[model samples]
Target: MPPTSPSRCRSDGVHLVLPIVERSSKEPSAHEPWYCIIFSHRLTSSPVESIQSTFSPLSGLINGIFFTVIQINTDVRSAAALLDQFYEKRRILIVSTPDISNQYYKLQNIMVQRAGCGLDLRQVTVIELLGLPPREVGRIKENRLSSEVIEELRQAMRISQAYFTMVLVDKQGMDRERYIDPVTSDELFSYIDTYMLSTEERERMENNRDHCD
Candidate 1:
């Protein structure tokens, strides 16, 4: 296989593979660094050596980029369990659209790009589900969810893939806010502060609101 060719390994009905992203000049200003997600799901006596030998040629390339695997099992229970990992740890902001060219998605991406500090401060993980399957899943920063997982999220939220939709899931893994149109950073921050944050978090947010911008 070529150095950049994605090696596919299956686990619980999901495939973990590397992504080859082709960007265009008309695309929004989201810089995605090259990443590799390589691992074997089935445990074997020599799994480590097997994986190392398979991608040995690409070792240098892999080391040059940031990489981690996000696997999604299509089973209903597994999907829920996958999301459970984020429960009580991070708030989820899911942004989905049929395509990235949607005006609402573009605006949301720009807003999110500018509000990284605020998102980090609030422990929010932005998951962008752009484009249709069997196309590759989209990545916003380091979060690249599988198409199956994205579909699960869409179905869970009852969001139509034909339109732009944004859903905010709080730390407790509950849907707190939904928007069909683009939302501003100030609005998101205010909502989180009012409804999701604890008293201490709210006070800290008040003190650091200016820094988040």
Candidate 2:
């Protein structure tokens, strides 16, 4: 029909195409394609990466920094929530196994790793969660948890001395990630840099954005 329809598609099939235009994300008539230049500076070593294990003050952001180290034979959920009420800083709860009666080799391992020294001590809270059916030492958040909770969590976490199990949580008192049998200080520090520092930076960015907003 009509030379095989030399026109654009339409309901009536009678519209002819006239003009078309194109656009790009570049300057018009530019001789060279646009390029991105990144200005960078020589990265200086931070206090935490000292050559002789110097004291680090949590990257010198110690004004509002805090840390808690807990060692216990309680349920994970109950103990975690219970230990968190001690302070308003970053908290680390090391769930102990049933045989965590007297031998504290596990805790010793952590201290030897530069985790509970210098500025880390100021930010960390060390508590021993010994005895079966972990119990709260004192009233926290105005209420003490039941023994059932501690028992349930103990079975779930299955913390023991034979093998190692560690958790790396965020500053907001949330479970970010967990570790088991970390062999070296680098592995431990790697997660701290990745999760801890990043979380702190993200929080700082959000606060700045809110202030600007």
Candidate 3:
């Protein structure tokens, strides 16, 4: 079964519509969340380099989790464009060094794939980083960013030629979590899904309270 649209869809757009079965049949529905997982720089071009999306099929636990992990090759301008679009919208970003071989990035690859993982991708944009030479960035390369934005990120994230890091940017586009060299996969996973997710929710709850007050 594919997504059905009540109205016409654009040729260039992606439309996936599924019935909300768990929700009440009498009540109106809202939009489903979309998750974007960015790959900051050149991939190793190895099969193992990918974030494995496979999950256990036990008891249809996956559908309860409704997020998709989209790996965008750097292509800096497009990435910059995407960031601009998402920053004001519902998105969370995960930034990491270019080395996908790093333990942290791989953990995110797993975290992004889980159902009921407790993070909403539609409201979050994930950013991963690389250590590429500025001269290597070009229109043709998929893993590149605007020079100005790159400089901004380099300064904000304290990127260097020496360390592998992962920086988590919250919905406000503020840096939430930063992990540098020698961080283990267990530590990385906990930092992101546990602490970060809880902090994000806590802020959201606070905002909702503020709004109602």
Candidate 4:
């Protein structure tokens, strides 16, 4: 027991041990790993074509187009509805043209002016003058000849007076009575200022105008 007791004494003792593994301090945790995913769709060259192509996939991601027209009242709702319907179907073409006046060519001048600012006038093609009274259509041709109307048209269209005069001559053979008077610079400026103002401000101005009057 004296000689064997040397090894027997160590066997009765208990020992505590722990295991360790080396890891990078910069490594993300299993619950906090970095990850990213991306998705994309191709588009066509033409804006109209691109709109049509990407519409299905991108409709949910984009606000649909808005169009304003001047004289063609019927076309406005119809066009808007068409665009809405197309967008709902995930397909669309945002073609917009000003409403052509069927009542008086005087209104058409205003439409032309607005159209010039908002649209490519050259792309406009004459379709059948559907549902318009013959007299109304005739009025458009007749108004093109009037010196006063021509001048008003030029001013509103923001083009040279001479250009409108020539356009009138080319469109209509003879002159007619001027329907709209020439707007003064003050009047024009007032209109522009009103246009630039917010809806509340415009309403206030309108109320003030009515009260003053």
Q: TM-score each candidate.
A: 0.61, 0.36, 0.40, 0.21
Task: Compute the lDDT for candidate 2.
Answer: 0.33
lDDT, residue 187, model 4: 47
lDDT of 1: 0.60
How high is the CA lDDT of each candidate model?
0.60, 0.33, 0.39, 0.23
Q: Candidate 2, after superposition: displacement of residue 119 in Å?
A: 6.8
Clash pairs detected, candidate 2: 67-123, 67-124, 67-125, 68-125, 69-125, 71-129, 72-129, 73-129, 75-154
- lDDT score for residue 144 of model 2: 31
Where is model 3 poorest over a 10-residue stretch in terms of lDDT? 8-17
Instruction: Show where candidate 2 strays beyond 4 Å.
Output: 1-88, 101-114, 118-122, 126-164, 198-213
What ranges in model 3 sit over 4 Å off?
1-84, 101-122, 134-148, 181-213
* Best candidate, lDDT: 1
For candidate 3, give the lDDT of residue 88.
Answer: 41
Which sequence of candidate numbers ranks them by lDDT, best first?
1, 3, 2, 4
Model 1: residues >4 Å from true position, as ranges? 1-78, 136-140
Q: Which one wins by lDDT: 1 or 2?
A: 1
Whose TM-score is greatest here?
1
Q: What TM-score, to 2 decimals, does candidate 4 have?
A: 0.21
Candidate 4: lDDT over CA atoms?
Answer: 0.23
Residues 160-208 of candidate 4: C-alpha lDDT, one tens digit per residue: 3211111111111111112133333234334434333346445534443
- CA RMSD per model (angstroms): 12.6, 25.8, 14.7, 31.5
